[model samples]
Target: MKNLVELDKNHFIHPTSSIQQQQEYGPKIIVEKGDGIFLTDKEGNVFIDAMSSLWNVNVGHGRKELAEVAKQQMEKLAFSSAFSTFSHEPAILLAEKIASIAPEGLNAIFFTSGGSESNDTAIKIARHYWRIQGDTQKKKIVALKRGYHGVAAASTSATGIPEFWSMAGRLMEHVVHAETHYMKGTQIAIQSLREIIEQEGPENIAAFIVEPVQGAGGVIVPSEDYLIEARKVCNEYDILMIVDEVITGFGRTGKMFGIEHFNLQPDMITFAKGITSGYIQLGGVIISDHIHEVLKEKSKGTLFHGYTYSGHPVATAVGLKNLEIIEREGLVENARVMGNRLLKGFQKLQEEIDIVGDVRGLGLLGAIEFVQDRSNHQRFAPELQVAVKVIEALHQRGIICRPVTYEGVDIICFAPPLIINQYQVDTILERLQDAILDVRKQLG
Candidate 1:
């Protein structure tokens, strides 16, 4: 253990982590193995993976089928670039399968390595599509404040989280942010977007990107008509709508995609995370037939964008098998059932706990916002790091969750795997209750 800690401290670089803490303590837990919704660390202590390990891992872990498919694909033809007509069966079949399950009219798929790449690609393609249509000036992007896209350059620029932008440094200048759904309500959010569009002049805007449910920004589920109204506003301005479903795709939302819950058609959708259920890296952008047809007709030559691992054979194979497992096991329906149980549990906690201010969830994604005074919805002092403290308490009790601070409020999020069972749900609630109790005592 000491050797491994030394190795990690000396050589490894973690993402979105505290470097000072890592240098002082190495890792919080060195995960050795995972099965279903539980993870075992190197020290043999088991934990409930309540956050689904970054809100991916929809199928849980230790799935032999995904491993077998990956092995077979690797043995058959590990990798061959899909650049310029070169292709593989896994890539082609996976694309077809994704199209069949994706929202209607989003028939075209462009493979990417992961969510960040998918987001970056979506930004580029949106501008490229407008360029092809002879609107070269329509290159700006509009995103929602408190929405998280990815950590890549363009995507990071689109992120409404101020801290991410500060750390990323020198973000793209074309991106602008609008009010989030939590600003007032969906109606106010829609109006704010329209105001931003008017201020920026729609002629300069290429696309408006949003997460159907903002994941990292506190699992914020907006009003049902939020996206619908926003889509109408975009349509009114000729701005393409892009949905980032990296965390809400697959079965996390209990509907394969979060957008399906809204029943709105987006011009482009960026997906990852659950496509292969973390078995392998795979993500892509599904464009509507309109964008595809425009590109097909007007592109001069050479798209001038792609990744070495794009259309990777093993990754696509794993994705195909992962989708198969999700369907055959009825995991999506399970997510809906289990998610309701979790949401109800949070609501119950809110009723009992003084600090639990807001409990919001949909499908398997949920969050419990903590506050100083529930009556006035006063946030705890930031210096106290209340959410982080609660998360530490939860972690000590053999549960893993994430702390989300957005809009100057702290929240603890839950996004268990879609395969979670009733028993596990109950266990999660029991443990979480105890953890909150511990924090409350400390606070008092």
Candidate 2:
């Protein structure tokens, strides 16, 4: 274990991690195995995977069924490119299954390797769709503030978080962000979208991309009518709507897809993560029938955009088995039921703990924000590192979660595996309460 830690520190440059921290502390935890909702480290310490390991793993972990399917598919036909009319059965069947379950009129699928590539593909498709129709002016993409797409070049530019921009100097051009999270009582956010459209000259805008419920941006669930109004605005200006479901798709939010919560029919839906329960790498963009028709009718010789692993056979096979497990076990419904318990637990914590401020959740995705004064909702000083400290305490208490301190908000986020049971939910809440209390006492 020591040698493994030393090797990791010397050779591994982890994604989305601080290099300095890794050098100083090695790895946070050397996870050795996962089963159901629990992960065991090399040191034999057990932990509840509360964040689903980056908001994926909807079907939990250690599923031999997915492994068997991947093995069988690889042995038979490891890989075959989907480009140039060369196709395979796994890709075809997976695409068909996804289309059948997807919202109405979204029947076309374009496979990619993962979330970032999927989102980048969707953005390119939106631009290509407009270009094919001689709307060459429609090149700009508008995303919502606090919305997370991916880390690819185009996806990063479309992402609304500022910290992501600093990773690589000068993100892609022609992407802008508008206000978001305005509830039913306020139309400021929607109005902001309209204003951007008007200022940018709707003709210059290709698509308006957003997440149904912001995940990394603190699980911010917008008002019920927020997306409905945004959809109307997009329709009014002829701007295509793209929903980034990378984190919210495949039962993460209780529903099959997060857009289902708002009854939205977007022009494009980018998805990944839970499709295969993180058992294998797979993702794709689902396009509405209208957009498919446009592409079919207008696209000339080679589409000229695709990834080497666009339609991996083994990955798609694993995805099919993963989806089968989700349906057979009814994990979506389980997520809904457990989500209610989790939210209630959050409410209980908020009521009992003075530092616990706002609690918000949608399906299994939830967050608890910390405040210095509950009466005025004043935040603790940044130096206090309240969210980080609480998360560390939870880790010590055998729970895994995430901390969101972006834009002056101190929030602890949770998205446990959809297969989690009532007892597990209660356990998470109990430990979380203890962790928060521990942090409070330390602060005092």
Candidate 3:
């Protein structure tokens, strides 16, 4: 274990992690195995995977069915590129399955390796769709503030988070952000989108992208009508609406896809993470029938954009088996039931804990914002690091979660595996309450 930690520190540059913290603490926990909703470390310490390991793993961990499917696929046909009309059964079947489950009119699938690539592909396709229509002026992409797409070049540019841009110094051009669900109201948020389109000249805007429920941005669930209005606005301007379902897709939000919760149909839906329950890397963009028709009718020789692992047989096979498990076990319904319990737990925490404020969630995705004074909803000082401390406390108590500290927000996020039971939900809440109390006492 020590050697592994040393090697990780020396050779591994972890993604979206603090290098200084890694150097100071080596590694926080060397996770050895995962089963259901629990992860076991090399030191034999067990933890509740409350964040579902980056909001994926909808079907839970240690899925032997997924493993067997992967093994069988690799033995039979390890990989066959989908490039140049060369396709495999796994990709074809997986795409068909996804289209059947996806929202209406979204029938075409463009495979990518993961979330970032999925978003990039969606963005490019949106532009290509407009270009093929001879609307070359439609090039700009508008995303919502606090919306997290992914980290690829175009995806990074489209991401509304500032830190992601600051880290890489801006990767792509022609990307802008509009107001998200602000405290004022969803109307104002909708107005912000309209205003951006008007100002940018709707002709210059190719796509308007957003997440149904903001995940990394603190699980901010917009008002019911927010997405409906946004879709209407996109239709008004003839702009492609792209829904980034990388985190919210595949039962993470109780529904099959997060957009289903709002009854909103998008031009394109970029998805990853839960499709395979994190058993293997796989993601794709599902295009609406309208967009598909446009691409099919106008696309000339060679689409000119694709990944080497676009239709990897092993990943797609694992995804098919994973989806089968989700359907057979009814994990989507389980997510809805467990999500209610989780929200109720958060409400309980809000009533009991003075610092707990603005608890929100959809399906299994949830968050609890911290405030110094509940009466006025005054946030704790940034130096206090209240969210971080509370999460650290939870970590000590065998509960794993995530902390979102972007844009002056002190929020602790949770998205446990869909396979999590009532007992596990209560356990997470109980430990979270204890952790918050412990941190409160420390602060006092």
Candidate 4:
């Protein structure tokens, strides 16, 4: 087992990590086992998992019950294609379950292996739908400047982060980018979107993609009126409204979908992370009736889309069970109830810490923006890597959290497993306070 660490130290490469640092400093984490609300590393260090294992483990770790569902489905049939000819009971059941819970007009489901593929499927279907409707020029996808969709080519174009685009030099043709709410005022966000739409010409625009509550882009929650205005503009312009709920779906923001909280109608909703709570790889798009009918009735060709892992039976089974747990256990309402508690507790940290520039969130998803000098709203210099340091310090204390590096300032986002209670919240806040104080002290 020690050799395993040695081998990993010598040879393993990890995703979204500093490869050079790992080689020089050794492995950052050696997670061994996890249970509800907590995890332990190979060194026997234990801590509350505050970020829900990158914001997907909603039902929390060690869900033996969900495992049972997977075992049962695997026993019967493990993999099945959504390819036109084949059908599976678990897929049918999971679709019905999804349709029952998703927002109105989002009826049909197209499965993928995970969030990135779901975003890919979404963009293709959008372009195909426009082409089917005889509006080939309506191929542009506009996303907020700081929004995150996924890493696939099409998804990356819509992702809004210039860094994520390191894989591709520029956005794919006709894929547009817009302004996010991170700017100080609402007028800027509205004006930026309007100007971009006008410059691009609404006629050329096919879809406007957005995350109801921006997640990876720093959990920026738009003003109440922003989406309403965007919805009106899209309607006036005949552009499809695509809401990427990959992070905010399945009750992360106190609602089944973050759009549900905003009261806006989106033409499509892309989802994945929370679908099976990361117990299994599963993702899918929720299609509005208008788009669904157009693609089903007018579109020719193979729908020209699918993955070998699409609607994998075992994944669907776990998703179904994950949904069951969310419902029977009332985790959604629990998140709403408990999320408010977390927000309230976070407010205390804001009051106690002078560096905190702002604190904002919805349901259980919240963040605190740190500044070099809050009185002037002065941000710490980017090279200081203050947020990154805080995240690492928090991890050392056993709480996993992320520091969002964009949006004018750095932020530490709190999105624990929706299953957390007040006791756990307090415990986490205590460690987080220490982290906050440490950053403040070092920076000062």
- Estimate the TM-score of every prediction: 0.99, 0.98, 0.99, 0.97
lDDT of 2: 0.92
Q: Please give the distance, in angstroms, between residue 47's alpha carbon in candidate 1 and its true position after superposition.
A: 0.6
Q: Tens digits of per-residue lDDT for model 1 on 15-49?
A: 99999999988999999999989999999999999
TM-score of 1: 0.99
Off by over 4 Å in 4: none
The parts of candidate 1 lying over 4 Å away from their true place are none
Q: Least lDDT summed over 10 consecutive residues: which range in candidate 2?
A: 179-188
Model 4 over residues 91-186: C-alpha lDDT tens digits? 889988898988887789998988889888888888888888898888888888888888877888888888887755655777877778776456
lDDT (10s digit) by residue, model 2, range 1-444: 999999999999999999999999999999999999999999999999999998999988899898899889989999888889999999999999999999999999999999999999999999999999999989999998788898999989988889888968536889988987723233888889999999999999999999988899899998888899999999999999999999999988889999999987999999999999888889999999999998889998999999999989999999999999889999889999999999999999998999999999988999999999988879999989999999999999999999999877799999999999999999999999899999999999
Q: Residue 357 in model 3: shift from native, Å?
A: 0.6
RMSD of each: 0.9, 1.1, 0.9, 1.5
- The residue ranges of model 3 lying beyond 4 angstroms of the native Cα positions read none
**For model 3, which pairs clash?**
none
Cα lDDT for residue 44, model 3?
A: 97
Per the 3 Å backbone cut-off, how many clashing residue pairs does candidate 1 have?
Answer: 0
